[model samples]
Target: MVTEELYAKDSYIKNFSAKVTKIVPSGVILDRTAFHPRGGGLESDTGALILGGNTYRVTEVKFEGNEIVHVLEKLDGLREGDEVEGRIDWERRYRMMRLHTASHIIASIAFSKYNALITGGNITPEYAKDDFNVENKDLLPKIVEEANEIAKRGIKVKVYFLPREEAMKIPGVVKLAEKMPPELETWRIVEIEGIDIQADGGPHVSNTEEIGSIEVIKVENRGKGKKRLYYTVKP
Candidate 1:
């Protein structure tokens, strides 16, 4: 059976309970989970599982087809059909959440000002890098400044689902230059109030103000038409 992804609807869930549905050499599969699998440029979550007072350190989380695999440091006591309580590392997760939201703000402002589309990127607990299909490197500062300004506005961030056809109609719903959202009947949309909205599947802060100030660490030129902006969030 496919595991229920609780984070899709609520990104703030740090602790949860679920039953072990399957066990393999790689990891254990839970019936429901809040752990976000490593994908879409966002890192996987790390946490611990409690079973009969024994704690299993979850080193990595990933999606194998429809199953959510929780890779643990030791699986000695966990068994299929057993119950477990999982807790994600809040400090790390919160940092990532701030970076993720900051990335969105940067992307949105860049797109509106320069008509740039995101080519690729990575978000981690310490920093975030977003690649754009723009040749002008000088625009980086303006984009960063605008993003920080938006974050200071304290706009609320909203997440919801919409039909694929309807979502595609929005002017800038799909912001990635090379990637299209999965071919699903419905798409998950993240809207940064009146500033920006796009199709995304990662945990984010509830408001832009939670992102604090976004500081540009550096910019890299990755060949022609590709520029990556490296940044970090400061509280």
Candidate 2:
């Protein structure tokens, strides 16, 4: 059965109660979850599940088809139909939220200034990186400046589902050059008000102001026409 993904609706949900539906060698499957499975160039959420007064550490989370599986350090006493309380590592998750939002801001800035498209990206609590299809690495400093300017604007970030056809019509909605979002009737779109809008299914902060400031840590030349920017958000 497909797990009801609470994270998709609310990235701020840190804890949730769920009933175990299945148990595998590695982990257990829940009927619903706020734990985000690893995908979309983002890392998975890790924490603990409390069951029968015992805590099991969630080492990993991933999608097995449409089902969300929570890999545990040990299955122990968990069983089907068992109810448990799941908690996410909020400190880490929040960092990623800020980083993910910051990446979008940087991507938007790159596109606006140089017409660059996002070739790739990865998000982590420590730092985030995005690759853009641009030739000149000299624009790194300028891009960083523009990104901070936008972040200081305190733009309101909004997430909503739109019909695939309508979402595609919005310019700059699909910034990734390598792949397209899953083919679904309604696509989840994340928008930073006037700054950026793109088809995304990942956790993000409610406002750009939450991102504080982003520092460009490194710029790399990944062969012709590929420029990579690595950045970290200040607490």
Candidate 3:
């Protein structure tokens, strides 16, 4: 069964209530969830499920077809149809929100100023890394500096949906070097006003100012035309 994804509309939701739709050996499936599944290069969110006085620690969340599985530390007491409350680890989720937006800021700068395209990336609570299809690793320092300046502008970020045909027509709608947005009827577009716009699904901060600043912690040469930059966000 497809679960209602609460996070799709509002990333700030920290807690929610849902009924247990199913139970597997690994975890339980809720009819609705705010827990973000691990996908789109972002790590899964961890939290706890409350049923009565007992708490089940959510270790990892992932997608299984259309269903979102909330892996739990224990399943001895959970049953299908039971109601439970889900509490997101807000501290961790907030960090990811900041980092995710910072990634977009850096990426947009890299693409616009240097003609680079994102090859790959991963987002975690502590840090974020992105690989670019650019030859000059030296350019990353300038990109980070530019991204910081943009972050200070407090540009409002907007998320909306558009028809696939219409979205594909936009320039730079897909910045990834090797992937495209899932072939859905409508594409979710994340636009960092006046700076960048892309078809994305992961959660992000509502404003660039929330990112505070970005730091280039490390850089690597993946191969010809591929350079990776590791960075972290501070707020």
Candidate 4:
């Protein structure tokens, strides 16, 4: 059975209760989960599961088809049908939320100003790096400045689902040419009001202002027409 992914709808949900639906050597599957699995260039969330008065550290969270598997360090007493409390490491997850949202803002600016497309990207608690299809490295400074300016505007981030067909028609909704979102009937769309909008499945903060300020750490010339920008959100 597929797990209900709460994080897709609510990024701020740090704790949840779920019943074990299946168990394997690797990890356990829950009927519902707030745990964000490793996907979309973002790291999986780390946390602990409390069951029967014992705690199990979630070493990894991954997707097995539509199911979310919470890999544990040890599953000594876990069993199917057992109810458990899942609590995410908020500090780490919050950092990821900020970084992920910042990525969209930065990518949006690059696209608007230079018509660059996001080639690839990754998000971490400490920083985020996005590669864009741009030739000149000199544009990095201006893009960074504009991204920060947008973030400081306190734009409200909204998440909603739309039919795949309708979502595809929205301009600037898909940034990566090769990395399209899964062909689900309904696609989750994250929109930074008046700033950016994209078909995304990853968790993100609810406001651009929550990202504070982004500092460009490094700019790299990956190859012809490829520029990588590494940035961190200042607290």
Candidate 5:
């Protein structure tokens, strides 16, 4: 099934209409959607799926066997073939977009300056953190300062889908593990023009300047010689 990634193509899409195609035990699947699924350190989108003048609040969205399920507070009168409008809570989404973009910059800069590896990460509307293999925790302040300097450049963000064969050609793109699903013909890649690039699946702002002031707040030594850096931006 073709999942329409509204966030990838149009980060600003607030409202859209789709037909209910499948109803499962967990939720209802729409033919197309603007609701973002929970994954890649980003929270699931929350909003409403409207149909026939009735509003059903959307609580979560995810893919189930090629179908996009839009979990609701209550199913109400929603049914297959019914056309519904997918509305995103833009205020929340835009904040995530900004934070997510800031995160990429932080990781990108770290790679360039410290030769560190981002082991893991978590994202929220206002802030996000990335785990890294730092040689010296004391140098974190320098990392933050460097990341902030790059953030100030207000770099532009661009995203694209690459076929597995073509995507493997980029030096920065790392495939950490063997393919779990052979069905995935392509991978989503995020790139900061002239700076960094990674295979990622998340929403981001059009420009790095939109990230505002990224403050690297806390850095913790999480054992095994790995460190976690937490951060937020000042509006």
Candidate 6:
């Protein structure tokens, strides 16, 4: 078994084709793929796989142990050794990338300004969210304005891999997770220059400027010291 290559990192793999090696209830397995599996609260890629002049709609992209699964609409004539052309819904993907990156910007800014720690997050094509440590309810309006300003500045967003030992040496890398992320020696790190950075695995926009209007839609106190923020970045 081999770990599937998550194409979200590249953010520019427009198309691909692969041979089917296995089939299951949710989706079929391909030798390779450009579709992203569901993880990190980001939705999976949805598109079409064209084979033998027939197109199978890919409804969900997921992982089964080590194999990448492409769930599809029931269609006739799918079998082993078949070659299929995969196409990603770029418009939707682009939105998700922007939203995902914006989440980082907000998280970075909030963490630094308030010395808060993130407890959880959820990202979707239309919007994204984060839970932060909050001291009082009076700060909602102020935090929202600051986050929107960060997005408007369009700071640089870059990705890089750090050696595990070297990564631990970095000032902001969190070593507190119950299980550190896998392949962290080659950690896919996201950096909003002069702002925020973290070990992340998901699609992101190349520049912070691409994140158009960022709106802090809502904020609520989930419990003691925790605040949840619901946000959407303008496309």
Clashes of each: 0, 0, 0, 0, 0, 1
lDDT string, candidate 6, 15-41, tens digits:
888888887777788887888888877
lDDT of 2 by residue, 52-148 (tens): 7799999889988877889999987888999999999999999999999988888888887788988888988899888889999978768888888
**TM, every model:** 0.98, 0.97, 0.98, 0.98, 0.90, 0.89
Clashing pairs in 5: none
Best by lDDT: 3
Model 3 has an lDDT value of: 0.92
Quantify all predictions' global Cα lDDT against the true fold: 0.90, 0.90, 0.92, 0.91, 0.77, 0.77
> Candidate 4's residue-wise lDDT over 10-64, tens digit each?
9999999999999988999999999999989899999999987799999889988
The TM-score, computed over Cα atoms with residue i paired to residue i, of candidate 2 is 0.97
Whole-structure CA lDDT of model 5 = 0.77
Pairs with backbone N, CA or C atoms under 3 Å apart (clashes), candidate 4: none
Q: Which ten residues in a row have the lowest lDDT in candidate 3?
A: 106-115
Off by over 4 Å in 4: none
Ranking 2 against 3 by lDDT, winner: 3
List candidate 1 stretches off by more than 4 Å: none
* Candidate 6 ranges with C-alpha deviation above 4 Å: 1-8, 138-141, 174-179
Across residues 1-235, which tens digit of lDDT does each residue of candidate 1 receive? 8898888899999999999999989889999999989998999999999998799999999988867899999989778999999899888889999998888888888888889989999988989898998998879878999888889999999999999999999998878896889999999999999998999989989999899889999999998999989999888
Alpha-carbon RMSD, each predicted model: 0.9, 1.0, 0.9, 0.9, 2.3, 2.3
Better of 3 and 5 by lDDT: 3
Candidate 3: lDDT of 125?
Answer: 96
